[model samples]
Target chain A: MSDAALRSPLHAEHVALGATLVPFAGWEMPVRYTGDIAEHTAVRTAAGLFDLSHMGEISVRGDGAAAFLDHALVGRMSAVGLWGAKYTMMCTPEGGVIDDLIVYRRDWDHFIIVANAANKDTVIAELGARLAGFDAALEDVSAEIALIAVQGPRAEEIVARMCVRGDDDIHAMRYYTAANILLTGDIHAFAARTGYTGEDGFELFVAADQAAAVWELALAEGAGDGLVPCGLSARDSLRLEAGMPLYGQELTRDTTPFDAGLGRIVAFGTAANPRGAFVGRDALLRAKAAGPARVLVGLVGDGRRAARTGYAVTDDAGTQVGTVTSGAPSPTLGRPIAMAYVPPALSAPGTVVGIDVRGRREDMTVVALPFYSRAS
Target chain B: MATVPEELAYSAEHEWVSGDTDAGVVVTVGITEHAAEALGDIVYVEAPRVGDTVVAGEVCGELESTKAVSELYSPVSGVVTAVNEALERAPEAINADAYGDGWIFKVELSESATDLLDAEAYAASVA
Candidate 1:
């Protein structure tokens, strides 16, 4: 696609910082601003700002919003109160995941769902079909919303400084919760205390026209704490280190929540659960009982030779067991780590496996999830 | 952008060849600054082990960034005399200083060094 057809609010800022621009999810995104390691280190050590406007935002509103969402999504949306957000999945009838999303409960009658950019249309279509008989309205508001993530240890302080109104209250917002904030002058932003980087942070949702101003304000406020404008490259590495799943990588249409090891989010029986039925519930319940054939697990290489996506995962005897979904030479861990699906027998921690890197089988070991975790 | 050192020979693949070319023709090879710029960031460098044999245009190492993985091809046939042990600890040196401290491997070239490009030729090739 042409450069004009794909743009972000931070396009000029990225160019000013000499970022390597690349197209992702139909938007021109910065792959790396200054350097990947530098940006990655900034997020791990201090703080980092990310322009995440490419993520899709869909609004579900009206009387039956709660019931409609509970019926259409896998997570218990009825349990989420105002200002609460729950990570959930929309699935196909065959138990395959349509898209993993975050459902934010604005109120009893209004909800906002954030989905992967590439799966926006599919998710909207599925939700629309499921809400046919319900008294609800679904609208795709992706183009009008701009999302920015400020993540790391110093996130709260940095964000507070940017917003001149009652900055102290920002720290009281619990993780996975959100609130509307009145920033300096007349700028109003919806800030959610949620992030994929496994860091203490907030994701700000603002009008598309206000994105550049808010981005500049945050950067200026965070300058002292070594906050950098991180791009997609650092964002991927940070999320990988946190063991969070990506859409095309850890999630796909053929992959169920059970296979992805997300059963905890699937609420089978609850008061707020839909009455009649939902798609994929039966198949998912069956998989939950019998256990999935393959399970997603973390893999750590012996050295810096990363096991990239599509690399064959094998047992010690070189038997092909599975394939790597997402892999990278971790900037934080200083080694190659990957997420892959392996046979249930070989999913245990410390189980030795091999990753075929460029036709050569490199030794690896199955490890526990979340290669890196923030201090609570 | 960092300038390509005039004293070093370069390859079409953006690897720089430096070091002594007189006594036994020992040359150290690393990626150019321009290549590092394109790579965005350097996360890992899988350098060939000491004493390994490599052929020209063959991949002797691998370089991985957050976004992609690329093969570090050998610019000249040689026996790997030494690998950058520091890269195992801090691979970002390839991004910070692609020409100096980020030198990947040292090799004893098997043939004369006349096949490599000069600084101007390498720049022109990339352009």
Candidate 2:
């Protein structure tokens, strides 16, 4: 580990759990505890804990918060209900993705924007610069908060068990919503029904100083629900199977939401829902008119060899057509799956393409975005 | 601390070979526990074929894991005499026991293997 790498508030807890620590986005975080496949399977069948403190949480407060967000991001933030959450994105003036974000409406004039760890500073700077004309304040509360996620099929029961109050709220909570809850140590937390894993889960925002206590409480209460602490590997596989685009991988400064097939998140103003001008509104409007040059699509390999990131997507005649962004051997699907950027002509499901996995060619078929989805 | 068998020889590439380096004798080969743990769960193993000639300090196969894929190098030059075919269906056997049932392949030494490190020296280097 590098000397300059930062540590999470739950660092000692992770070490006590014998987690494999890795430096990611400047933070020394747990990549896994027991094993990747095991923790992945646990989330699918039972429960898994995740320390997401490395993610950036910035607070936006003041009367103009919602309007400012609606102007700064490609979403109708003003339309989000109280205690509601919306998955949105910030972009450059050129319609390129800056970072995908999840904004929580904590109150009428208070909101929280969670951003990717690596892009935290950049997002803060951009948000700060955009606040020139708005009556809002931006404060990075990432250091004050520690995020703990309990995700999976049994997550509800496990998280409910840790709460001293709000069990009924936990049981009655809706997805993409947040609730204020009190835990075993009388610690107040902002718990949200949101997660990167496709499974049903909750993300608890607690005080950084009490992070270990909350972690232990959840572990103790969830012992019966098989809540094993997971790492980045399982989290990556889970999010990939859910077809969620990762910031650095699937979404980049060069790619627009339209290219990633996530234009729905960009709510452009129209005659009826006349939203104010937001960042990238003009360029994204142009992008919508011209259509994406390369469309993001999912692929399933026909062979055992996986098509990894940067692998060339080739045509039948051995011509390079696209590039793979993220890939893995899906533990749930028992096959190699990947997300790649290909032309609109080859983006349809069942379109056959070849991947240059190392020196050999592995045939992959275009599939729908998600290779795996939980049963509702 | 990772387990390092005293009777084995190791390569900088993390492959462990049976102690004997005399020419014309077959030597068993597998990755050390240190390597397996560092690689996370081994999902797939691509061992050199039984007839393929593997050169020391050269990449001959691959070990694909959950997080990343690593090249498997031959510690000693030889023809692959045998391979652990059981790994095809149960690659996690490497993570379960990298030195025992996880032994990847056996090779008939084509020449005396040179520059092989003893268990103690290899352990110190990794440490």
Candidate 3:
């Protein structure tokens, strides 16, 4: 395919900034602007802006929207109020995860779901097929909506300055909530207080044609705070340090939500359960009761040698136990960290293991999730 | 991208080979600017220890960036005489100054391994 086929709205801006562009999820996204460590440190200490338009957004509207989503997703749909967002998953009947997504209640009868870019088509098809019997309308709005994520310590202040209506009081917005703001005459944009960097941030959804203008505004307003344009390389490092799971890496069609250590998102017997008959409920309940055979755990390596994806996890005696799902030399921690799945017996914190990186063995220690958490 | 140093000979695999025949045919090896650009950012580097024997086209080290890990192949056969100790503390120097203080290892060539590319040839190969 031609390179023009996958260019995003900010392609020219990225090139002008001397970004290293790479193919990611069918889109030509910047892997790093200037350098990875610089961008990573910028997000940790100051602020960073990201062009996230490649993410898929699908909307479900109608009277049965809530019921349909409750039956289709793993999280409790009824508990979320209008303008509330919940991180949830769509799983297969055998309890394997199809995709982990965020569901936003746009209104009483409208819901918007955002999914990974690579899995957009599959997610839409599956949702449509499942909701065919229900009274709801499903539409794919990925091509029409553009997203920009402003993240870091000063993200809210920067956004407040760019927005015409709201003051810095928007900074008071709690996490996982979204509000609509009128940036100009009759031009409304939705801003969600959510992020993957484990920092205070907002994701703004705007019309496709207005994306570049909004990005320019955010950059101008945030320049004084040391806001730089971040790319996929820094994005990976930041999220890895925050212990957030990437869809294909940490969750996949063959991996169950329970096995991925996301049982808290599943509401089976709660009062807010709109799940009359959701997919994977039975198998998930059984797995929850009996406990998953394997669980995902965080690992910290002894040195700078990173244990990459697909590296084998083994005991000191060389018995193969699990495989690494995602690993990197964390820019923030200045050491190698990873996430992997091991047998239940070896999933506890402080379990000593070795990662077979190529032909060499690197010592590692199993640790709790969220290697770094934002101070409350 | 950083400038390719004119004094150094380069290999098709993007490694720089610099040395003098007067100094017992000793050559210092490091990755090129183009290689560092493609790798994005340097995170970890595992160099062969001093006195370890290496053959041409053999893996002598490993370089890990934020995106992926790649094996560093030796351009000539030799025994490792010196290894970069600074990489253990600050590997990003490879991304910053690939040709100078970021040199990875030094080797005393067994017989002056031939067929190594020059800077122009190496640049053409990458282009």
TM-score of every model?
0.92, 0.99, 0.96
Clashing pairs for model 3 are: none
User: In terms of TM-score, how similar is model 3 to the real structure?
Assistant: 0.96
TM-score of chain B of each: 0.92, 0.98, 0.93
- Runs in model 3 with CA error above 4 Å? A1-5, A184-187, A271-274, B19-23
- Interface RMSD of candidate 1? 1.4
* Highest-lDDT candidate: 2
| Candidate 2 ranges beyond 4 A from true positions | none
- Residues A140-185 of candidate 2 have per-residue lDDT tens digits of 9999999999999999998888888998899999999999999989
Model 3 lDDT tens row, A1-376: 3556577788888888888888889998898888888888899999999999999999999998988888888887867998999999999998888888998888989999999999999999999878977789999998889899999999988888877886544766789998887563345688899989988899989998888888888888999999999999889989999999999888998888888899888878657534567888998889899898889999999877898888999988887899999999888887899999999999889998999988789999999998998887
lDDT of 2: 0.94
Give one digit per residue, the lDDT tens place, for model 1 in B1-127: 5578889988888899996554368889999998888876777788899999887788888888877888899987878999989998788888888888899999898866556789998888876
For candidate 3 chain B, the 10 contiguous residues with the lowest summed lDDT are B17-26
Q: Comparing candidate 1 with candidate 3, which one achieves the higher TM-score? A: 3
> Which one is best on TM-score?
2
DockQ of each: 0.66, 0.73, 0.71
lDDT of 3 at A44: 92
